[model samples]
Target: MTETVVANPFEQAQAGRPTGPLVQGFEVIIGFETHAQLSTESKIFSRASTAFGAEPNTQACAVDLALPGTLPVMNKGAVERAIKLGLALGSHIAPRSVFARKNYFYPDLPKGYQISQFEIPVVQGGTVSFFVGDELKSVRLVRAHLEEDAGKSLHENFIGQSGIDLNRAGTPLLEIVTEPDMRSTAEAVAYAKELHKIVTWIGICDGNMQEGSFRCDANVSVRRPGEPLGTRREIKNLNSFRFMQQAIDYEIRWQIGEIEDGRKIQQATVLFDPDTGETRAMRTKEDAADYRYFPDPDLPPLAIAQEWIDRVKAGMPELPRAMAERYVRDHGLSEYDAAQLTQSVALARYFDEAVSKGATPKLASNWITGEIARRLNAQEIGIEAAPVKASQLGQLIARISDGTIPNSAARVVFDALWSGEGSEVDAIIAAKDLKPMNDTGALEKIIDGVLATNQKNIDEYRAGKDKAFNALVGQVMKASQGKANPAQVNALLKAKLG
Candidate 1:
């Protein structure tokens, strides 16, 4: 007997919307379900420590174990964190939300059923906006619900037998679900990254993928542009952003191949093997009905008052989107530059401090996003750990703005400062003799010598060749031992040629 495939609710909600760009003549529809572990110190329904890396089963209390006569109690901190997320995403926080038992039998789930929100979640109808290589894309959010995490099934260190770790059981989690709004792998990855940033920025989750503080499950499907949505296969527990992209791309190709070969796509849960760079089915995916969801009898309904939400809003930090807009509005930065600067709180604060110290906003942005970012990534460190402080960078930019040193010379000072060769920006400039040649007479003489020797380039320049003009400028700079200011060289050369 054939099983009935349940249609994705997001696809139905987005019907008649323009289909995304096609891959192999079929459009891809993708959605996400991300579990962000809240930063609370205890489990959602118990007081067990939520700290990671504890010995297996040591942290599981009687409540987590679902012992007979044990009652589940709600954690107020978990609820506040949920409210923070809803406010950050501009989602609707339901005044009354219900917790239902998702009935399943897994060794890790000691309760035989997991408590999660089904019919009425805490957050609803939000949007996650991000940039996909300069073009802005916004993915609609379905809901973000409060839930308790299940324990882990450890397959390693056991011969032909798996071990269950209940230490992670009952940990507080906010499972954020997104609509089928992503069309390509790039968009999906960008959406995930933006969501991760929001959660981490607001201090609700640690956003640590390696430690399992945050995880993503991708639902990917493909269909003809005008046809109804195809059955989707979910790629489970993608921890790394790179792996997430790889998994989704491979799944899209695999689904298209199956449809072309006259086979129907099956709804299942698949896992990506990084060793082989492929996705293999783990098990058949279950629909909501299969879980037999029902409200839990032990726990009462969660009802949040407006006054409590207001208090959370009052204590919230400046959100990334708002901060980005402020950068663009007050500092005259491009949207892309602002977005890049606001990627993290530390980076954004560094930029702000540099600007506050009188560095030109545009120059500080270019240096921070270019050289500083490159160095940070190469060393695998954050902006807070940079050898050169914000004040030092601000001084460096000031030198460039005042024409005391060219950008090329400023970089030499930057290297000296970054490598601990010099402590002060001006001291490095003085010690390395990196100050640009400021004498107008000396610059004119250098230009004269360049023009007399490079007559071919001069002729080419007069014949409307822009490259030749640049070549003459290069010769003048080289003759000046690379200490000539680029703007001065250009102006002097143009005056002499005319």
Candidate 2:
């Protein structure tokens, strides 16, 4: 079969525009099609359970197996999830949408044709915005449609024969498609993460890459600057974010190398071999016409009312973008900090609770994104599983803000709290004698001693050397055994130098 290449309107608009950074003198173009398994209990078109890890062929009922007398029925839960996604992404939810039969033949597809949305999808026209390392980027989405998943073709266990597991048959999925808008692998991965966050935050999908619940297919191509889009090769089923990045980067380089060697990129689907860090062609990609898509007679067109959409919208939690904006507006956080805090629902909740418990916004942000995040990453746990409670962290931060403890002392208190050696922030501070030396006369004596011993540093400070001033402050802190208030030390040192 001949390869079919589809033109991207986004790329067409980029004609003659200033192109972004190039890979081997060719601009990289990428788009994504992600399949997020709807978090429903039953299959999209059948009553069979959609739970994972079930035995092979056991979950397939008459409707899932396409029995002669059985007819497919739409799952209400799946349709509601579609609405939730549309609302979450600011997409237009079609009042009426149709399901079509995507005709294909595979051993695992007992029905021989997969039911999906084609001509009229349920969601259309949305934008996913995320920061690719400080610079904000937005990717335009074409559509997100409801569909059913096919069974898995197991090839590992049997020798010379493949097994089919129908446990995933007729499972609900939302295939979210995007325009060819990303210019780099970084942007592509960021867009995928943002999309994953939205689907999971809205309770539509679990966003589990390991269980085949969330998967991405990246369409990658490279073309010279200001040229028409290149013929694309799709890398399919990138289950891990790390693998997704590796796969896309490798594909871009390979495409560029092929062009330099006078080879034309073939439109095809490829799989990423994580072990070798290479992508190999699986099949020549097909166009829409190749599938012969036609409305499924077994399932009727889905009709959604405005009332239903409004109901779903009302029940939806505050989205990440909105929460981030609130952080910027109400809490006075930078856009970057706001975005980082809202990476997950649990993390955002932790920040909010900490703030509510009297933690200063910027200080709380610094602590959580800095020390707390480092520890969480080291332990491979979410913020919800943190050893320090939100209230405890808030109280600790309050102590730092109130001049009762220096920032250095706060770390010691934090360590004590995290290790379960102490629970109350105040108790920990008292046990460690972490409270700063608050006595004005005693602090003055310590500062005088530091200034007398560090005469060279004091002389340099008077000669306008800022590092010398910092050295004097450090000397004071050292003499006070790290119990001196840093602000007080800085003020005293500057006065003595003058």
Candidate 3:
């Protein structure tokens, strides 16, 4: 199960290849199967609460327990949620879809089979497009089927014995499957993030990776360009983006090494050991036929009406892609910047609110993506949890726009605002006395004093040394106690020198 492998020269982190495409030697083929746990109050087929936490089997009911007398009844709300996802993803909602028994036996599966859609899924054929660096990549979806989740097999405690918790059993899930379109681990992660944004944006799923609300299974293989497709191994249950990339990178290197050393890669399921940064084979992979799928006799064919699709469509908010396009077309923001703003609903709202409050689109975009994002990542928080409000940020940007404070002074004010020192941007600037000296006469006096003191720099500048000019600018800023506008200082100094 364990093999010692060297580092991959073509790996993403170490590859040194430019962002657009991989180096010419290898081609990576990747696909994803993501399970987005639907946001429903009850289990898909039973009245048991779908609430995440409870004492082990307390949430399991007769139907979830697969008791002999119990019959499965589909939850209307779950189907509606599925239809909503289909509409959001631009997928087709089938008029009639059949549920099948995906036969499998595990300690946690009380029914020894899972109710899922096989041949005819509820949602079919959609595309998720996202940016990997500056490159725009699109991952095409094969089908998204509705299925009930299996229970967890708890392996901790109890002297070499395992336990089964059926609380998660019958929880509704949308299994989103994609074609093998991704050619790199980076692209795969980008596609995954874009999909996550879409699901959470539409309010169908919370998309919490830590709580197991969303998870991905990545199928990866490597081949020479224009060669036949290589065998793929499925890496299962990658909950975090960090781990997802690590697992795939390791698997690709392992497969490539195996092929190079005259060994054939095997088709199997693998588990990633985050601690060791390696993948271990778990079990042989299963194809659809191995599941022995058959129509579930207990559940009837699920049908959707055109009216329901229209209803869901009418209630749908602006999708991420469309919103990004609008931002680009109307606001003159770059595609990358627009996409970053639209990563989540809250972040997008923050940007929009700032712009509506009179902040320029590009300025708001820059601050949110650069300064704000840097701080948020450092604190390990999200836009919804930011201490500073969007309106406050908008006000600060306004001050910068009107030349009330220079950009340097604005940074100081931002720090104060972020740390709760002051609520208003102007008050912070006033209290700190960080306003730029806007009076041309006052700034000219300071520039003259600096020139009189720094005769050496003036002489160097007259000799055509550009560095000396920058040094004189630095002196002017220092003389003004860092309050002088840099652009204004530059203009006045150049005029005086010439």
Model 3 lDDT on a 0 to 1 scale: 0.88
How many Å off is the CA of 239 in candidate 3?
1.0
- The local distance difference test score of model 2 is 0.89
What tens-digit string does per-residue lDDT give for candidate 1 at 158-177? 99999999999999999999
- Candidate 3 — which residues are off by over 4 angstroms? 1-24, 455-467
Model 2: per-residue lDDT, tens digit, 1-498?
221222333334554434568877889988899999999999998889998887789999988888898888889999999998898888888888888999999998988999998878888878899998898888888888899999989999799999988889999999999988899999899999999999898889999999989999999888998778898899999999999999999999899889899989999999999999999999999888899989898788788889999998889999999999999999899999999999999889898889888899999999999999999999999998999999899999988887888898999999999999999999988989998887989999998888778889877878888999888888888889899988888887777666
* Model 1 residue 155 lDDT score: 99
Supply the TM-score for candidate 1.
0.96
The per-model lDDT (C-alpha) reads: 0.90, 0.89, 0.88
Q: How far in Å is the alpha carbon of 403 misplaced in model 1?
A: 1.8
- On lDDT, the leading prediction is 1
In TM-score terms, candidate 3 sits at 0.93
Off by over 4 Å in 2: 1-18
